[model samples]
Target: MYLLKRRVLQFFTMILLGMLLLVLLYSIDGLIPFLIVIAIAAPLIVGWQILFDQVQPQAKLAWLLAVLFIPFLGALAWVMFGRTPRRHRRVKRTSSEIRMFRQAIEMERIETANAVSDRFPLTRTLQKLGATGADGHTSTKLLVNGEAKFEAVLRDIEQATHHIHVQYYLFRTDDISSKIRDALIKKSNENVTVRFLYDGLGSQEIGEDFIEPLRESRVHVEAFDPVVHPLLVFNANFRNHQKLIVIDGKIAYTGGLNVGDEYLGKEEKLGFWRDTHLRVEGPLVRELQRLFIENWLYAGIEDDKETWDLFANEEHLPEYFIDEPKDSNGATQLLVTSPGKDVTIRDGLMQLMMEAKESIWITTPYLIPPPELLALLEVAGKSGIDVRIVVPGKGDEWFSFHATEYYFEQLLKRNVRIYKYNRHFIHAKTVLIDGKIALVGTANLDFRSMYLNHEMTIAQFETSSVQELHDAFLKDFDESILIDWSILRKKTNGKRFVEAFCHIFSPLL
Candidate 1:
């Protein structure tokens, strides 16, 4: 109810603001300038809609129609209400930078070994998925929930010898966050190069004073993209949703864990938070370090040979996956998609799912997938491929939860196994297929993750990791409740209509 009311209020607010802007333009009293501005803005708005519509054509049709019908008013509504948060420039890598990084890594791959063989049947798949010759010798430990993740991070920080690179979507100033900050400061004081990169929008609530103490201790702290004025909040679209930490270019951490009380189970509203974090120790740490370097550079940190050399230790063999559209050396491909990019990770995942052979296992907190994605799963299930999905019975987003449930009904009818996790909000984003391939990253099975946000996923092929992930899925399945199709079909007509309406906006939601 609160969410519905909020949306209603926001709709009116946007309408009022659009009218004011239109009136202001008309009052300019210069027909030529007004016409010029409209001409320029028209194409810009239309092009934006076309691009987004192509990405999710089905769900975006209504919005596209509304914009076309109303023109000025429609464009304003779309801009003010239709657009999702823009991709933050703070985390975006320029085409040149990405190209350079890919070239440099490709050159590095020439010196690496062909770790893929018949014994590792998934090597070709990995190469296709983007793993290729990017191999690293590393140990990976999965951390379940915030407590375990925090403990592991603290251990790495305490053992840091030379440098520590940290990037996170959110870094709060609460107890756990402060403890980590203090540790970083102490490490910096001891001459350990400590670099902290945080998303400006995600950590905006934390004041400069929170980082002041770290700077005082000589710790290098940088916000990914800092908004200088309140009026520019619209520009806060792009964000660094990646959580990464590299210690002395040897150990690293990734996965969904962020630095906040809610993540740590210290928030009153979200208790016993369930999440996943990976502690990786291997040559792959260098690749993780490289990603941090790229993000640091994007955050305006100067990158030099000295900083690059910290990760130049070639003695350790690390399997690194480079995500490029044209690389063809390996079957394992790394798919990274952002709002600005032509190929999105979400779409890539959908494509992969369409090619599934035996089964598709997906786990995510949010299940508001686009219509096409929902249809793909429905088709896959109808075709007799084992299609299974696990979502939180109770989600952090209430509307999203209901929206997910709405899709589950259709899936259930098609024999897709829909599991509602009652333990806690399952925040992991992973998908395993036919016990041969798996996707692990921050990308959720939703429209926002697919199109609006910048997301990265490591597609592993023919690896034991897939089996492990499958086993984990089965374990989770045991703890979940399978939705009854008959019960769902019995829902009231009005309720079904409401869900159908919500599902229509799944792309925008």
Candidate 2:
């Protein structure tokens, strides 16, 4: 009934808009001439804008084609969603708070410089891409799927004494979400500071009933770029896709699992969800803490003096922030990317691919790769690196799944092996290289994650956690069916047409 009402409302809204447009057209005699002028000038202006920005060549071409073919709407969309607004760019790059935040971690960088550099040559380049250098004192544990991640999260939330910071791209009102919500409310009742941030577009379906409880319980909540208002709906191009949690400034969790029952294999469609998450302790938790606070501030949440002193500034920094450099088993680094910020994860992954001599194993739900990453994969495969990618046999998204299917032939032609996990839908975003390092986080192998969404990833070097992740990949590969020429030939012509059609719109997806 609610959906029907929404549809009826939307229909009436469109009818009203059409009537208004027709009235304007009839009333203004010079409107046609003005429109013609706009049609001619808009494409030229958009073309110039696209070229001036740091858009990829292929994306630039796509935008140009869009503006040329569908002038008015395309130009309006480009203005609204295509590029980051100037204001966002300024705040992201020039914010004094961010500058002070970076300076706060300078000591960590200097202390780990020699050891991290000697071990990982790409550390310097990654650091330049808005990530901290590898810290040796960190300890990591690999959480295989949503069950393990949620269990660990609930356990840690129960133990949190100081504060609980939780963020998710999607926070549904299912059983698991309620479980976590109830846990958070309990902690808030115990006088623990609870801050919750969620992506407005991703969690738009969540109603006031779900949120009122949190607020009533004194859980500080904010939605990142909320699309609840009609005028704000078009701003859905950019989303905060990171799933993170910080507990007591000591432990952190991040990866692909969000607060949904579908992630727990309760959904009937995408059955038996397969994913990966990580638990971090020691110094890396501090970096994750900084990221949470940065995003919290970005959501426009103001803090009182006591709260600000609890989470911010050098004077009130957590004791866990300045963890002594212990002779740990391995080092860990973080990769964060926002829409207007540096494309840190993409560049870091490409560099990691180039550095991979023995093997490059990837597992992701989406498979749409940017041209640069695709080229790197082709080159690595052709150069005899054991390149293998495992994607979902069943997908929850339509266009992106077909777009993923479109790239199968190109990858196989270059000797890159592909596998479809048939047991269930594999939503893990992971990359294992040379049996030594692993990347596990929220970014997918798609344009949405690499360019549009805010993403965070963790790079684990020679850790026992990496080895565990490596073994998990091996198990998944064993379960998955390999895709070869025979598989490509078996696809129907209609399926091929759908994939090709979807591939054309890959940039927007």
Q: Could you say which candidate leads in TM-score? A: 2
Poorly placed runs, candidate 2 (over 4 Å): 1-48, 85-94, 100-110, 301-308, 319-327
Candidate 2 is scored at a TM of: 0.89
The digit string of per-residue lDDT tens for model 2 on 1-509 reads: 01223334543554565466566667888796775576679778887898887766667777778878866556665765577523342264336555666676555442355777688767776777667767878888899988899999999999988789999988999999999999999999999889999887777777789999999999988888776653335565677899999888778899989889999899998899999999988778878888887776666534323233345456667443646444467788999988865689998999889999999999999999999999999999999999999999998777778999899999999999999998879999999989898999999998878988889999988988998998999899898999999889999999999999889878766
Pairs in clash, predicted candidate 2: none
Per-model TM-score, in order, reads: 0.79, 0.89
Cα lDDT of model 1 by residue, 218-326, tens digit: 7777777675642333444345677888887667787777788888767775566667666666445555666777666556634423233233334322322322222
What C-alpha lDDT do the candidate models reach, one value each?
Answer: 0.67, 0.81
